[model samples]
Target: MTFDAYDTWWWPYLFVLVAGWLASDIWRFIGVAIGGRLDEKSEGLVLARAVATALVAAVIGKLIVFPSGAVAETSLLVRIAAAAFGFGAYLASGKRVIAGIVVSEAILLTSMQLA
Candidate 1:
């Protein structure tokens, strides 16, 4: 089916909603279905966990090392310092993820304001 603006303005929105759901939610559903059966110590589970952690680390590393937009304008040293502060907060807060995120964001924003 061909989509034309004159045909319906809402078509594009509908298309994006359906496309995005299929692209992301399908995998989530499949993961839920399959993940339940996997043993915690199974190699596949271990690899999946490692891969997920690596992906998160890679994203964080990219943001720190090669930021874009306004963040890119910040000095690398300041960015590194903010990350260090966040990591320290995380460790000091008994590894609470939210605490680390909040502290890091506060430091980063405050540094930006000062800079």
Candidate 2:
């Protein structure tokens, strides 16, 4: 006899949850095991950090330049202004990430309300 998992709604969710957890958690555990032996200041680690930072910057740039969903409804000017002001807030607040996010979100919402 063959069992059809999709016949039950919970089975799909449970399958996805377990599969996703296993997929990511395995790598996380492996990283924990290996990361301890790596030097934080090594060239490889430095390059990894740089690449991660660049990816974040690229994502932000993409959202600002070619957003989707609600963000796409806002004008390019508003998006650019929000990002610029957010960066200014980050700098003015001594590089606190939360401050940058709060300021950026505030700018976006306020401008959306006004427009």
Candidate 3:
């Protein structure tokens, strides 16, 4: 028995899709069984939210301040300028997370275009 290119290359991608969905659905099922009760209002939930937010912010900060790969070639000043403007727009939009994400992405694309 021999394995072809798909067994070596594409099968990994297929496995990732299947495994990723299975892993993600575990959390979804847990949340569903929990059902948004006082559990949602618990200290643990609040802490989890804060920690997740902080982790995401830290990643974004690292990307802007010390990007790697091709983005590393972009000027630090440009990154700061884009982040500042994005943060401003985020604040102006009443601190909506989606707005902040969109603004940051828009700024990144604009910066990439300039680069």
Candidate 4:
């Protein structure tokens, strides 16, 4: 009478699919529905964008300052240098996200090899 997800192989996959949809895709659908009515230059949208950008920056800062796993193996100087070069690449590449990521990853990989 009791359902045990672990008792069946397909149940775990079904649970994961349902959980993933609820966790992420549902938010996307909601955002699309509500965002469709908002003006591109609305104050609400601008504030939301600013908040999102700040959250990303804070996360990046945390990773650099209090790194864990493989990244923690590198010296603080290496991390900072990589971030600086990545920012410069971002700016020089007309603010392209891919440019920043590629430059930062390359710097980190090279530094890790050298260290």
Global lDDT of model 3: 0.79
After superposition, the stretches of candidate 3 with alpha carbons farther than 4 Å from their true spots are: 1-7, 10-19, 66-70, 93-115
RMSD of each: 5.2, 5.7, 5.8, 5.6
How well does model 4 score by local distance difference test? 0.87
lDDT of 4 at 72: 95
Candidate 3 collision pairs: none
Better of 1 and 3 by TM-score: 1
lDDT per residue for candidate 2 within 3-111, as digits (tens), equals: 3546876776677667767866987898988865767899988998899899899998998999999889899998899889999999999999989899989989998
> How much lDDT does each candidate structure score?
0.84, 0.86, 0.79, 0.87
Worst 10 residues of 3 by lDDT: 1-10
Show the colliding residue pairs in model 2: none
Kindly give the stretch of ten consecutive residues in candidate 1 with the minimal lDDT sum: 1-10
Q: What is the TM-score of each candidate against the true structure?
A: 0.66, 0.66, 0.57, 0.62
Q: How many residue pairs clash in each candidate?
A: 0, 0, 0, 0
Better of 2 and 3 by lDDT: 2
Residue 88 displacement in candidate 4 (angstroms): 0.3
Clashing pairs in 4: none
